[model samples]
Target: MIKNLLFDFGDVFINLDKKAPEQALAKMGIRTIDEEMTTWHNTYEKGLITSDQLIENYLKKFPQLTALSFQQAWNSIILDFPQERLDWIIELAKSKKYRLLLLSNTNDLHIEQVIKNMGAVRYSQFQNCFERFYLSQQINLRKPDLEIYDFVLRKDDLLANETLFIDDTILNTAAASSMGIHTWHLEPGFEDVTQLFEVKKALF
Candidate 1:
């Protein structure tokens, strides 16, 4: 039986438009999200570079840029947060049948927007759904990298077989599976996972 559930926040729970970056940047004369975006994001997610460095890199490339512009541009992917999902997650958390943990490859900017978009109360309610929450920027480790999974499993003394990891990215799912953690891929537009997994009884 699965005694723990590891959730990914971005696309799995809240909606994320993967195509938004290209669309948003296109308006700023950035024809494509190429090396600059890829390199900056990888470095930032790996905790190898600071948020400021990322802003400066882009700002230098486009002289007419402000912090707010960067914030909006970078956070274009995070769409709406559905109330039903929040309610479902909270119900599952209250069930106490399984340990709930959140693991996401995220940066400070993304989190700041979430707090702003969902108000303090809603954001707190969302966070309360997890026994523990892990963000790549804060933790200095990211998914698809073995160390992050190891960090969660070893630090929590959690057995891989007892945990179910959920992520929208196949790479992350594969990484967890390599270590024996069962995984579910939340496909784009697949809003509800109630029928997908045997969730906590409380969510019923």
Candidate 2:
């Protein structure tokens, strides 16, 4: 039986534009994100660069875009966070059926936009649902890395066999699965996270 539920916040609960970077760059008149820019992005996620620095750096690299234009492009990655998901998770948490946790590979810039788009009250409600919520930026670690899984497991004294991690990314799922934790890769056409627990029982 699954005693704990670990969820990825992006597509599992909220929707995101998968081509956001491409689209954002197009809007900013940048043709593409080059190899060096990719490293800068990773550095930003790892807390090596501040959001302001990232904004300036990106804009400077292009030099053809306005700061506001880049800012808009940056925030375009953020998408709708539906209330239905929140309500569902809230009810699920209240049942005490499992220890709920949130583990997401997200950075400060995206979070800032989520806060702005979701508002403080709604965002707080979402954060409060978790027994523990871990963000990659704050932890200085991202997914597809084994240490993060170990971080949560050790922190909560979780048994891998009894922990279920649901994420939209295949790499993230693979990492957790390698550690013996049950995982579900959320796919829009084939699976729905809202019905996960029930589906697991049905599989039995």
Estimated TM-score per prediction? 0.91, 0.93
Task: State the lDDT of candidate 1 residue by residue for 81-132, as single tens digits.
Answer: 8887888898888889889999999887888888887778988998988889
lDDT of 2 by residue, 1-204 (tens): 788999999888878887886887886577777898888877777677788888888777788877787777777878878888889998988888789999987888789988998889989998998999998888887888899999999999999999999998999999999999999888854776778866676422
Worst 10 residues of 2 by lDDT: 195-204
- Cα deviation at 15, candidate 1, in Å, is 1.0
Error of 1 at 4 (Å): 0.7
